[model samples]
Target: MEKRDSMDAFGAVSLIGFAALIAFNQVVIAVVNEGLQPVFFAGLRSAGAILLIWLWMRFRRIPVMITRETIMPGLAIGAVFALEFVFLFMALDLTTVSRTSVIFYTMPVWLAIAAHFFVPGDRITPVKALGLALALAGTAWAILQRPDSGEVSLAGDLFALGGAICWAAIAFIAKATTLRNVTPHTQLLWQVGVSAPILLLAAPLFGDLVRDLQPIHLWGLAFQIVVVVSAGFLFWLWLLSIYPASGVASFSFLSPVFGVLFGWALLGEEVGPVIFGALALVALGLVLINRPARAQVPQKVA
Candidate 1:
């Protein structure tokens, strides 16, 4: 089977898998929040992911050439990573999964929009434009639906939006800066390694670090470190390295769809007609965006 530069079968499958893992992650965070304050948990997760990735890198003998050139931009990316999770974890704590997911997963659209201006080959195509439009519509529709129980937090919604922007900013940095040449492992290290300390220092300001800390919570943190951060984020950046930014960005639209389903199944949250319809739009958009266009060949006149 041939692998194309846009989105190949493996790329599509990998992206969908990543989206599902991230969707399921929201539920895990909600559960873990029972034992840990959001910021502290996020900080600890980053710390854990750093250690995990470092071990993997060491075992594999992956040389992360951290020269003077990569240091400043690397720290900047890590700072962006810190801000992204700070807002995201807080959003998860303050809002329902459905609401936060709908709001937060808009990062792809934010990223595509920025990449259009900054990235050379990542300019929005007609299909991607359509996808972005539908994505925004679906996300907005999902956000508008009132939850059955817990009152929605405006602050949480805003935090989610901020997190989306921060997420976009990271993609922009990767595409538009020298960091593009850096290995995905090193890029991820910049994020988790730098974020660990920044987040840890800020964690205490948010209040108590631990709630009713339990064994399952420890397990949850471990899952986040191993699967979501270490494995999932690394996979995402790797996808970006091999595929077009717009195509990869478009696939992330599935996350909120999975998020809503998980929220319904795991948290017993309501999934109504509006959400179902929105999920369809998002899924449809993903198909459209990922469908590779064929070359138009000119015919000679006889």
Candidate 2:
């Protein structure tokens, strides 16, 4: 199929659904953490995703070969991927879904900053600078707002921030390295394939592999393996293939909002003005950052 120049109705609806699915996934993680250790749960998700992704690749006839040049980056990205989910799961275990989502979804802000120094043809402009400032401030604001509730944890907030950084690094590697030569499916294969063993091996260092352990938790893990980790990611990559990347990315701001709502609605988590303010700033900042640069007007010749 040919790529569309802009998002249409189908794209808009699909993107919204995807955002909501991702936001709800945070709630699932929090629930699942009750029965399984955070790091162990993350490892299991990666381990399970490996088989699903491999099967999909085989079905689609997409080659999973990694060239010699991409091997270093493949390992690098996989290691970073492991670190990302470790922090994310740990954060969710220690903090409220609202707080984690608000901070974790700031991946684009960090990615833009990293790209400024690392990726060619990706220099930061004045508008992007403003966006960066706002997003960074929003992140700080989210981290600093502490209520009397026992649900909030400073360490958890920082872990969420770390997860966002690792997520940005993964995107940076995809953009700036030879890994870009491969299909998105192949790159995703690298992430899950390499991270599974590393995460599982490191899981014991975090804590025991299981908590009280329940069927709901087992179901949660299966949902993550099949829905969020495999199908959800593949759907996102499919969207990128069909729409302008920026246009597709513009909808990301919605995920945090949906996350906050889901946290409040599903888990009975509190949502306050401070978090709302942070969400507004972050969302606006993302909009600005992803906004296409204005076309330059030609000067009249003498």
Question: What does the lDDT read for residue 155 in candidate 2?
Answer: 92
Clashing pairs for predicted structure model 1, backbone only: none
**lDDT value for candidate 1?**
0.82
For model 1, state the Cα shift of residue 156 in Å: 2.1
For candidate 1, lDDT tens digit of each residue in 1-302?
A: 33356677788898889889999999999889889998899999999998889898899899886988888889999999999999988888877777777778777678778878877866788987997788778766766654555646677778888998998899778767888788889989999999999989998999999999999999999999999999888778777768876588667668888898899889887766876776777666655555556568999999
Write the residue-wise lDDT of candidate 2 on 86-176 in tens digits. Answer: 9999999888999898899999999999988888878889998898888888889999987877778999999999999999999999889
**Where is the poorest 10-residue window by lDDT in model 1?**
142-151
- Clash counts per candidate, in order, are 0, 0
For candidate 2, give the lDDT of residue 297. Answer: 100
User: Ten-residue segment with the worst summed lDDT in candidate 2?
Assistant: 286-295
Please report how far candidate 2 places residue 113 from its true position, in Å. 0.5
**Which candidate has the highest lDDT of all?**
2
